[model samples]
Target chain A: MKHIIVYIEPKDASSLKRTSYEALTAARSIAGDAQITAFAVHGSEQALATAGNYGVQSVVVAKHDLLSTYSSTATAEALAQYAQSVSADTIILSGNASGKEISPRLSVKLKAGILPDCITLENDGGTVKAIRPVYAGKAHIAVQSISDHSIIALRPNVFTAKQEGSANASISSFTPNLEAKHAGVKVTSLVKNEGRLDVAEADIIVSGGRGMKGPEHFPIIEQLASTLNAAVGASRAVVDAGWRPHGEQVGQTGKTVSPSLYVACGISGAVQHLAGMSSSKFILAINKDKDAPIFKVADYGIVGDVFEVLPVLDAKLKAMLHS
Target chain B: MNILVCISQVPDTTAKIQVSGDGKSIEKTGIKFILNPYDEFAIEEGLRLRERFGGTVIALTVGSETSKEILRTALAMGVDKAGIVKTDDILDSYNVAENIAGYAKSISPDLVIFGRQSIDFDSSGMAPMVAEMLDLPSISVVSSWNIENNVITAERDIEGGKEVLTCSIPCVISAQKGLNDPRYPKLPDIMKAKSKPIEEIASCHGSALVSLTSMVLPSSKRVGMIVGDSEAEIASVVTALHEQAKVI
Candidate 1:
């Protein structure tokens, strides 16, 4: 791929999100001496300067009054305009919520094929091929783009964003041709979930299910998760029963996650649940029933009452981690 | 409102999936296809919008003849009409979005709705793609929303939080799971829906933008260490996670 443009999602005005660096690293790996540029609609000079550590030498910030408030269509128009002006053949972005919204519009605007939520990307014989999960991670398929221009959205937490070398990122500005019609949707505000981590982007997850019995007993799960600095996850039953928010649900209908470590607490592994997290690097299932289905897919299993085992486990982990 | 609700039929989540002989598609035989679970929220939202403001809610899909079954489900759920862009050929996301946008262009609906993503592909790209194609604003994964004076205010789920957004009418939206509880069609409505006519249009899909080259099941080999939860066993588990798994 030549003339690659990586869309940078800002964490705030001062810094870029971790996923942006992941996309930047992904682009650099497959770039093969191609010119790599970082593109963002928001970010301060310092935030844009950090792209140099990820192997980008140039940055293009789209400047427009409408861009101060986030609109997927307008932001996409800005990126598309810049990509077209530079004749960029490849675009890369983080496969997060914002990227998911913008990539499709960029595809339509640029007439480019897109590979969404890709876990692996390889450039084989001048053609870029990608591997992405389908059927809720039950299976994976290898896909590729045939169109002249292409977009790739890398899944969060999968690609390692490491600084290989440093370069001075040259900052430039691009003004997109936007009109009143372009500002169709405006993001009024963001209601943060406070300190809770989202399962979609967590490296470690401690998940509870029907075995937890009720909403009142989730502190044990939460405490253990806090010890590990992991996100708290739940099965569909708990979410449907209103014990937890839909954001933490992990299953076929809910979010699919592949964390470095997954601890399934009191969860009887349903096929649908397995479909979501079987791809985790290590699985630890804790249940009282020795014959629970969760054991079938777990790397380690503690077959005992969670009420008894969790306290001891939590205390032990606290000691070990804190020490 | 003139709402357009888009839906798709997918293999039941409980069903096992196998790759087709072509290595590029899934085997359909012996699989029970049902209305995509997320689309139920979309259809319900459309019906509710129509109920709130006097309007027509038309359920639309792009698939082969068999896909009309999902339209029947939408009809039973109380949509005013149903239509399908008939095609048996396997079309990519771009092709499907093109067909949906083409049909949407002909009949200018005040609002278009879709499931956040199809379970089979799980791309979550259609609503935004079609919105761009039609040059309209769009919101996806909307969990809650309200309409006043033809302006829509929606709250959508994002990582670690939610975003509140606003757009005028003549927009597009995809329903998230918690948008509303979908209604189950009664037996009488199901029987009546059987007789409802579904308009069939020839597919005008463009060339595929992406192509699936291969498919394979992920190979996962676990350690499969089972231990009791005694104090010693608990300590051993912690040791394993630390020294052996090296993940602690």
Candidate 2:
């Protein structure tokens, strides 16, 4: 039987990101009757308890003072040691920024194959086949692991998180022996974007493009986003024009987001922009031009001035939600 | 102060991608290939660093002969030298990283830079893996960078905001978009780049950890109906969203 391990990251000491649960769901689907271990560095009891709800047989928590803060190299070393201890054949992680950073280190350390940003996976007998987008979503490639051990980073929101009856999983602690060289890189400070959800994690995103004209016009998009409890995203053009920060840009060059609902306002859908968000479950395009490329992929199109449409929609949504 | 920039050639973002008949790979016909856009930032950063630090900047790529075009673009951007790890095999990220790390060991550059991820594979693994192999510090998705007295300070985008990090020299950094504006190559520079020699080396045929089983296009979305552009349609759109689609 194949041994699978899902890497979990706690958002804080008390809670975990939703994507970790999604990774758990993916692990369970591929584990079949094999053993599943939820692994984390500096993971708390609360996070392990949550992992237990996903039907994992056991949880491995690696504790180190250096791990209290995020150190990609140190964490990878710890996780690799833990994986070796358990002889995990397959490792799964969320394809978020942290996972993207750490997976490579682990892959090199273990000399294992890695598939990043996978959308789907299936176990064909003993070998696991996975599908992932390539060429920035222009096409998909299905790959199978040829090595004895492999790593898979699942794209968030693609796998549905299903809760199984609690397994009351036993927790094991692992302390890795890391040297001073492993702590070469340090996070000096983090400037948090207060009161705003990151576009990558938000369920709904209201985005603007060059059609918003200038930085001054972004507040309307923000208003709509706040009304809908959504995050605000910008197209590459606006970001290049210095109207928005790069972190907020959504495109092939920026963050790939797959929210439940995506509203593109004042955006003439460039192929690069669509490549990032076309996988959204529901897309709504609001632009004055009827022939905007966004409308081609949008589930619903509203050809109107965003200035006029946005306020009306915002008011309507506010009322609907309040009532 | 030597710097090495790693780049990848990818289909132009606007290129039409078609699946091959065998369902194994993308059809290459009629597609315009260009340097991965994010790599442009890496090249630009390398040039800027060389200008400030007085050292050679080398551009390297691992791919087939077609990837030489990518090296020329880097040379045109003022990279002092270019190299290609020539291979046509579809290698996985681990193999690619091992090859890059192997080359890096021979060069022993002070700084190694890469695009945050290649647009083709979207695997943001190579730079860190190389750093690990070389036992150097590395940071990814850096938007701003400064070096003072051999110490590198970088600001990178995290989930909500940015994180400021500090590391010593002989490090790896992956460039993100908006780090800096890449320059357009002048005609003279483009001509010079065409004449510059690109050193080609045979790639290490490491065993691929992952093998392609098949490839397929994403299932297309259903054809959506267009509602009229009237204020009256707002209510109907909301009703359709709430009742028909139920996404909100």
Candidate 3:
């Protein structure tokens, strides 16, 4: 029996929308006979209760004054304390902003190994192996954690949460003697990106590149996205040119998203760009060049003009949805 | 003020990439190592901050002694001193950040800086992890920063836009591109860099915490069918997109 824990980020729950359940799934899968403890920092009880529906046996709250703010060290220290208390063999964290920040710090404190941005995880006879992207998304690396303590940052959108029953998971409190001087960084304000779907949470995304010509040409992608109720994205080239916001950029430098379906428009698949979006469940590429590398990874590819094609597809989609 | 900038050695982006026979590691043939593009931004910002307020800027790198080349480059760019945490080990970013934070604390700098992410292993988690270890306030991917009365103001990239933040001094910041174009090293500065002090502290602990078990390259692509050409080809492509791909 192995015990697993999830370091939850409450603020990102709504933004990420589904990582709690996914984290639970990964935790349960890894923990055979052992219990699963879901830890949420300075968040409400409702958030912890929500964990029960996802099969978490208990919830641990690191209730403290400073927990309300984002303290990488404090959060890491707190999680490390909880892991020690529960004797967790593995710690599961959602591959979101907060988890990404905390997992490594916790790994350092515990002297544990960390598998980052893993698309999948499995345990074989007390050995936890995680699959991650390597070679800039051109390859997959399967890594095994040999340390007594292990951390896995599950790639978002790979696992859909399945609910069993709702119950009050046994809740406990945890507090780390956080040095006041050490709780330094704080998330003063989160300038939430509005009007577009979060790539991390989106089921489908449509991304464009420099081939769109300019920022003005983005209306076509927006229209297509609007018709399909999909998220919008951009290539590094477009973001580099300021044609799109940096958040919209999908590449190694930008956000790494794993959507159910990804439509790449007018973008040649550069390796750096593909590393971020290669985990998409279904990839469709549209470009004018027949030899673009994206077409190799794309399950479906179209070499033509995005400008004329998007509107027609939008209209047909609207007609089909209306019909 | 004491500022430390952590630099990584990476192959030039424009260079061709060749993988090993098994596709596990990058083939270093013909590739030249340079200071990470983002860390260069960190070095420039450190120099800028030092010039604005008389301070010491020390550049550090975690690699073999040859990695000191980038430190030398930073020193030539007017950084006061440089150091190399010589290790041929590829520690996970966590271990790397831990080693860096420990070394930084040993020096007791007023501020620490690095790029948002390194090119080789772009976890983008190094700065935050270091901040976490030291419990230092941090703002990442900052385009602008200001220092006044022991407080630091900065900005970071958010989902849709950017967030502006202010924290106390002795903070950490990960540099974002366009923060400042790194300045060219002058001959006088290059000559002076030869005389700068440097230290190599070999920490025999940590590293090799995580081992890459297996790896595979991306599957080869199929020769996709080209429907037509130009704007008119878009209609056929869209039709194919709906009927064949069903993406619509």
Candidate 4:
């Protein structure tokens, strides 16, 4: 029996993210006998076409007024309906931003158990055992739910993207049974940083800590990230200092990122911060303090000033790209 | 208009947590419970809104009797009422949400507010579930809110930036930090909190959506190599990256 993956569509307002495609490839690993269904809880024809490229067996859009605005409650209720409709034994979700907000609720709606922040998933007999980091990033624990319909939220970038084949699944719309009170809390506005990649969805990222001094020095780190086409991240200290927004922070209290390449310019790698990004495929550390905890997890270490090292590395990368 | 604030009584971020004798959970000895930092922002916003527009602020928590102590903390900060859905054992996030939704259904407040996610479990799902169970609109990671008659203006932090939203009232909004600095409880307010009305509810014992079979502490650090201070020592250190550390 193959596992089914559900790429929960947020209320089709925001642009589609790369994590959606990455999640489809992850579902392929488990989608064999049981076909995978990529669901759009509140998407339109344009959103459906946008989701087509992600290699999934089918894209089912639950067209409903209840989904008019994004609500974890509405999404959970809608996805629960789909899970039962298809008799899906295993449901895979992205452990990034949206998944963290809704997976627990969806599991409740379906009376299922979820293994969250799972970095790997495999079939065990009829059960799905998942590997996830626990007690921060110091250890990895394997969880096997002794229950029916296990929900697993995979960490971003943990599974390699394999979209060679297009599943090109059928598209359908669903209307949810929305209640009036459910529409009570409405969003009035939005604010966001421009050009930078979604920290959780980035393939490469460069983060700075309070060691970066202030917001004035963040531009250097941004320059390095721009050179690599990577994302920008910050430590709690920097965020608390008002040098960066809380969204850019990486820690137990911040956004967790698992990029292919992670460059820590001034971060000391506090346990909380490491819990967010320690799963990266490769990590590079450049700090003035050699004893920074980040070096413990780094694949490459550079002990020097970030101001001096960043420009040099940026130049080297530019030269390599030009040459 | 009335506003309900769902608050979680969590261990202070600075609290020292250690494994118990059996190594199964955080040691409970001498632990103090406080309002979840994120929820404090929610409660504070509720109070501020009430002050400006004239509404009641009600604080609620689902936890043991001892956890209710945090309610006084909220009351001392000028909240109108406090409620606790009594429960013991590690109630999973889903069950907690079910209990909260039940509470919301009975009270039927015009507006509900919650922290985007709690510090524990890190699931951040309860308020949304309650809103859904009641069939209300909810916005997560909400950093700002402005109310105008029947409509509410909210700001949600999305990937790369924020999206300004305009939704009607009677909705759920999860307060993100930085939206406002939680007001400190003054001496007079703290004294008056003892007189504030508190209601205790029976545990709903609803089935939780997720469960933690077990929890264990992380492994200890293997070894840490320290570097010397000085410009001359830099070259030898670079050598260790390729040699001893095998990281270059």
* TM-score of every model versus the real structure: 0.97, 0.96, 0.88, 0.82
Best by lDDT: 1
lDDT of 1 by residue, A1-323 (tens): 67999999778766678899999999988888688899999889888988988889799999999899999989999999999999999999998889999999999999999999899999876667999998867679999988998999987767888896776578999999888788899999999888889998788999999999999999999999999999999999999999998889987767778788999999999888987787788899999999998998899999999989999999999999988
lDDT of 4 by residue, B1-248 (tens): 78899988766554555666654456778877667878888988899889888879889899898877789998998888899998787776556777788888888888899987676545566665666566676667777778888787777666566767666767777888778989899998888887777899887855554444344554443223333333334344334433554423
Top TM-score prediction, candidate number: 1
> What digit string (tens of lDDT, one per residue) describes model 2 on residues A209-263?
9888889999999998998889999999998888987778898888889988899
In candidate 4 the C-alpha lDDT for residue B228 amounts to 36
Q: Of models 2 and 3, which has the larger lDDT? A: 2
Model 1, position A189: C-alpha lDDT score: 97
lDDT of 4 at A248: 84
Model 2 residue B99 distance off true place after TM-score fit, in angstroms = 2.1
Best by DockQ: 1
Stretches of model 1 off by over 4 angstroms after superposition: A166-168
lDDT tens digits by residue: candidate 4, A236-281: 8999988987788887767778777778888988777887788776
Tens-digit lDDT track for model 3 on B1-248? 89999999987655555666754567778889888888989999898888888889999888887787788789899887788888886676766776798898899899899987777656667887787778676767787777889887676665445566767878888888778989999999878877777788775455556777666655644325455444445455555556665655
Residue B218, model 1: Cα distance from true site in angstroms: 1.4
What clash pairs does model 2 have? none
lDDT of 3 by residue, A43-95 (tens): 66666667777788688888777767766556777788878877887888887
Which 10-residue span in candidate 2 chain B carries the lowest summed lDDT? B222-231
Docking outcome class, model 2? medium
